[model samples]
Target: MKTARAMRGAAARRSGRRGEVLAALWLMAKGYRILGFRLRTPQAEIDLLAIRGRTLAVVEVKRRTDLLTALETVSLDQRERLRRAAAAVAAQRPALAGASVRLDLMALAPGRLPMHIPDAWKGA
Candidate 1:
């Protein structure tokens, strides 16, 4: 039973990573320059960071069996963490600090279309 549970958890993580890759590709197709994937900071981690024109976009990718589930995954605290992580990245790249920074959420569900929500959160 423990082995089964571990396998399931591993599979879920793998699926989530795959969804993130798909989300990254979708953003690239939209002319966004991909900066990093699964970027880790001391404070938090950002799933995807991209640049479009002069705008810096911090993206969170959530994958679930359905759209509703995916949307629910991005909680307030999670959004805040993304925002902070974006700031950390900006500190390293000073040019990004001067540009417009935006927070975005991308939802990917099996057998469904990908949904991109720009400015998904506000002051959280």
Candidate 2:
């Protein structure tokens, strides 16, 4: 039973990753240049890093049964972590450092179209 549950969880994570990739591609179509996926720093992991003109976007992707749950997944601590990660990424890429940074959330729930919340949170 434990093995079955683990497998299910892994499958769900993979599915969510796929959904995020699709969403990233959709953003690309809208002129967002994808910088990285699953970028990990000492502080945190950002699901997607994208750029549009002079704006740098750090995206968090959540797959849940409902939008509220997905939105809730990104807690205050997680937001701070993402902020640190974005800063680290910017430090590594000087061009991006001068760009305005924003946090974004992409939620994908079954039977519903994906929802993107730009500037989802401002780190305190």
**TM-score top scorer:** 2
Across 1-58, the per-residue lDDT of candidate 1 in tens digits comes to 5698899999988987898899999999999999999999976788899999988999
TM-score of each: 0.88, 0.90
Q: Which candidate is the best by lDDT?
A: 2
lDDT of 2 by residue, 22-112 (tens): 8798788879999999998999988999999998999999888887787788899888889888988998997886888899988888788
Question: For candidate 1, which ten residues in a row score worst on lDDT?
Answer: 63-72
CA shift of 55, model 2, Å: 1.1
Tell me which residue pairs clash in candidate 1.
Answer: none
User: Which residue pairs collide, candidate 2?
Assistant: none
Candidate-wise lDDT, in order:
0.84, 0.87
Instruction: Report the alpha-carbon TM-score of model 1 versus the true structure.
Output: 0.88
